[model samples]
Target: MKRLTITTLLAVALLSGCSSKEEVIPDVPPSNLYATAQTALQSGNWTSAIEQLEALDSRYPFGAYSDQVQLDLIYAYYKSDDLALGEATIERFLRLNPDHPQADWVVYMRGLTHMAQDRSFMHDMFNINRFDRDPTPSRQAFTDFKYLLERYPESEYGADAKARMIFLKNRLANYDLATADFYVRREAWIAAINRCQQVQRLYPDTEAARESLKLEKTAYEKLNLQKEVERTEKMMKLNPAK
Candidate 1:
């Protein structure tokens, strides 16, 4: 009986080990793994690409294709809509290769990752009104792109980065205005005025600045503050709302 119990235990252990065989990673050359990752990427199989790329990165951290492998992995995460991983990967790459030649691109990608989080894909695709959403991600992305342009003034991505920065600014301004409008609708005059001023103060160059001035003046009027309303009116007259 004792021998049978021991044999049964050994058999169970062996079966468990054997059943897990499919989970084992095959011993492939790093180059081959990289090529497989590349093939997955080319096929637009982002999840597969990420799996292989992650395996390569884990198995051969300092391999010849380390830098490109990381970059491709970041892009795969982004394409797969796993933005948190994409962002974390970018931070890791930047930390590891601070003075890398492609650092600017990585920074730009980091910004894009945050931008992708600003609104859901369906929202952007359907042109939905999601301005009421939190603006933190947009703010983070704007700072990222701003740093990119400032640090890498002549980077190849300069032009496109600038365009995205402008878009982010507008999005932020819109968020502020939406919040201000919400306060106004609720008759929270002070809060509404504060949000309007915030938009104007931070984004005076944006088109939304004009709308902010309009809302600010309306808030002043609602509060029956003639002096404040007159001041806002003069400013509005100088920069009429478009």
Candidate 2:
């Protein structure tokens, strides 16, 4: 009986060792999924790329790669023109990492997703690539870039962010100018003046500045605002002859 009990204990220990040795560790880290997605994206296999990324999110909810994966997923969705998915991914990332180091980049990418979706009617009409009149996305892009500049001045991407902000600001100012011109053509002095004021308030240093001031002067004159018209005209005259 003693011999049998000892043999049974030895057998159990052997079984335990075999079980431990056979235990399967996960073959990949969550970051590996992101890397795979990147490869797929570069290959233009957008569907597969997104699937791999989503898998990373699902399988490793709190893994070390979560934040980075979330960011990359946003880009993947945007590259594929999956605007709704891109927006949703960004919203989720914001919820998770509101104070993340790269939060500004996330915000900028979100706006970019919307900008990508937006298209101009003129583009369709003329078979040319034109942008939409929607200033909201461009405005958001500017805000994101502005935040990066102000909060992380020493950031590696700071200069690029500022440059993009300038571009977006100019685009937004152009939209305002275009709308003001449309109002002028229709003899809508109040609307024209309001639009010009928008450019002055929102984009004072942009190329649209001088032209916007000129439009404001014409609008005030059309509305019979004598003093306001004279004030705007004086300002325009003082502006370097451009």
Candidate 3:
């Protein structure tokens, strides 16, 4: 009787372990997982799409849809407003598949992610100046877009990237102008002059160029650099709208 009880207990333990193991692991096929993720993406359910894609990636890292899954994951993360994750995923994709046919799309999406993050609630809703806040993200976006234009000028997205680059350049110039204005207000003549000079040299055709020239003139006058003041005044006259 004792031997029979011990045997029954061992059988029960083995059955319990097997049941727990099966319950813990899902038996999803790779194709089904990819299809489910695609469906979620098509339905605009970005969060669900991410979850499914992530599952597929973990289970079948080298599956037929692995590359496509990574690409879709980037879009899903971006759509879900997970900007940091989206950016990281794109960088990974670029690093791994630099010559991928869709490289231009990846680069463009990365630039868009930065641009989207640069816009804040205050800037969008209250019409607050973006230059009043941090400009790092905007600068980064501008760099990304410029790189895309330089590397893939004939890309399908080249025109849009170029347009965004122009907008970002203007914004960056305005940011420098704002800094110059602040320095002028604080009577930091040299710093003000430097900021204005950056705007004039780097963003000559931008609207900020006019304000930059005006600021530079004021700074030069404050520093008693009469020659510089005259030169700036002459330049400003030559380009009245500058």
Q: Would you list the C-alpha lDDT of every candidate in the order shown? A: 0.90, 0.78, 0.89
Best by TM-score: 1
lDDT of 1 by residue, 116-147 (tens): 89878689789987888998999999999999
TM-score of each: 0.87, 0.70, 0.85
> Across residues 188-215, which tens digit of lDDT does each residue of candidate 3 receive?
9999998888988999888898878888
**How much does each candidate deviate from the true structure in C-alpha RMSD?**
4.2, 13.4, 7.2
lDDT of 2 by residue, 1-242 (tens): 99999999999999999987555323477667778878987898888888887788888878887887788789888887788899998989989888898887786776577566555556768887332266776666676677667866777777777777777877887888888888988999899988888888888888777788888888888788899988997888876436
User: Candidate order by TM-score, highest to lowest?
Assistant: 1, 3, 2
Which candidate should be chosen as best, given lDDT against the real structure? 1
- Supply candidate 1's per-residue lDDT for 47: 82
Q: Model 3 residue 242 lDDT?
A: 29
RMSD of 2: 13.4
List the lowest-lDDT window of 10 residues for candidate 3: 21-30
lDDT winner between 1 and 2, please give it. Answer: 1
